[model samples]
Target: MASALIMTGPLWFFTPIQVATTVIAGMNCGASTLQSPLTWPLLQDEAIPAQYSGKQTEWLLHGSEIIFPPFNGVCTVANLVMAAYCYYKRNDGLATSAIASAKLPYTALAFALHVATTVYTLTIMAPYNQKLKVASRKINASVEKGEEKSSATQQEGIREFRDAQAVWKARNYGRGAVMLAAAVANAVALKVSAGL
Candidate 1:
């Protein structure tokens, strides 16, 4: 039980770190474009699109896109491992309490929620890229037309993006907390069942 708790608790920390690092990388990618006029056009107008222009932005968005499916797969595997562990402990003459039994269901629910969020995020990225492209074109055209205020409008959009990014960070941290709590609960239950 102690070993299980240690292992799973690290995953709780790890997932959040992965999520946060991805977000930071994404923001860096975006901010990088904003800072570099040369890259801005490429990111905003051409191949990638403006919304995904910055280093952090691109990294986060792409990482999320690529990593999420595998992450979900791993999560499913982890759930199975945890369920098996619980069963093994119980079969080894370990007393099972309601709390100990509940861990499997809770972990399963968390896994499902993680997968749902991943899918939702992936689906939204393309449309978001499209909207960003339109916005970037308009902003760039306005700037080309000698509209000084265009910069202000662009800044506003960037600010909003940063705000949204912060929200994502918060959500990620919250998910980490949930995982940590679940780990602790599972560990405690196991200890209690073992009279340790």
Candidate 2:
């Protein structure tokens, strides 16, 4: 039993570092994206049509789509596993109660943040994303068929697209803040566990 516990110990030891690094990377990516001129170009040129503006915003956001899933996946899986293992070890007399208690709250906080980010994305951002996708498809199809650029329907689509992108960006910023907090908590967990 002692041998088994020692063998599996590194998972708890190293996973928090991975979680913290991934979260911080995600936060920086989001903050930089949000601050980019192309992200909110209205400050530069208010005259740009809503359609083009929306496309820029959508594409900028798409850049993050590739990175977020893997980051969140690793954080969620690793932290939850670590938390459970810590609890098990403590109960099994492999870890002392003080160390376990010290580590568990931070690990649990990181896990909760990961879950919160996912829930926020699904509940708050999904609808806007769906609207943005639909509007983008229609607008692209019309532009492809060489339709006149300023048709009333096209303008309406652009307006919808822009609105969705704006809301998504704002929600994404909130998600980024959550991720930042998770990173900090994970780092603190690592420090607490290091004494073990």
Tens-digit lDDT track of model 1 for 81-112:
65555444433433333333544454445445
> Over 4 Å off in model 2, which ranges?
1-12, 15-38, 42-46, 49-55, 91-96
Q: Model 1, which residues run further than 4 Å from truth? A: 1-53, 77-152, 181-196
Q: What Cα-based lDDT does every candidate model obtain?
A: 0.44, 0.66
lDDT per residue (tens digit) for residues 143-192 in model 2: 77777768766777777776766676677677667777777777777766
Reference-based TM-score, model 2: 0.75
Reference-based lDDT, residue 105, model 2: 82
Model 2 whole-model lDDT (C-alpha atoms): 0.66
